[model samples]
Target: MNDLTKIMVSKGGTPADITVGDALEYRAALQEHHAQSAGHTLFYAWLRRLGSLPDDAPATLRNPSRATGQVGIEQLVDRCDLTCRPVRDLMVDYLTERRPGLDYPNAGQRPRSLS
Candidate 1:
């Protein structure tokens, strides 16, 4: 990835008040929770990552806040230049959000796409 994206990805760790494991676990929960739903999870995550989210983005892209997406977007933007994380990571996040019959907590609305 480009230097800018590296900077972005580096910022996604847990807050000073939280541990790394805690932050990862929380992100895992969000990914899994959203996965329970059918359709559009990946797309929503991508929109969140791109900062072009719709008003409903929070619910759909729960757990990781805009901060997460900002970091991800930075990574992606850098990646877009140097291919840091594969475009597939975005697709992966979207696909991982499939929980099928599981009930998802309110993550807020899904953000719309920039493209």
Candidate 2:
């Protein structure tokens, strides 16, 4: 918490005035320094419990990197490397129609079976 306190004081704000952006910047600094402390998460939670954060503040300070979006049907089918063009198009259409109910792993498996 001393690190966060330093950040807050440097910005001319108290601990209660720390924003989500401030927390993220701190996390980035930790990453840059290859630090592996979970203190930030604890401190963020403490601030939240004291009602120091906005209602829209995230429940956790951990910002996991995830794939931006789902892969397209064409991309999924193309990965299968089906030699038959007509069969590839058919798989694409079939997967596109069924994609609403299927997850990525299941959708990916369907095209591989045809290969």
Please give, for residues 21-105, the per-residue lDDT of candidate 2 as tens digits.
7877878888789988476578788778888888877777674322224567898789899999999999999978777555444
The TM-score of candidate 1 is 0.18
List the RMSD of every prediction in angstroms.
Answer: 19.8, 9.2
lDDT of each prediction vs. the true structure?
0.43, 0.74
Looking at model 2, the pairs that clash are none
Lowest lDDT 10-mer window, candidate 1? Answer: 13-22
lDDT accuracy of residue 16 in candidate 2: 85
Off by over 4 Å in 2: 64-115
Q: Per-residue lDDT tens digits of candidate 1, residues 18-74?
A: 232333454465468874433324544443455554444354534545533435434
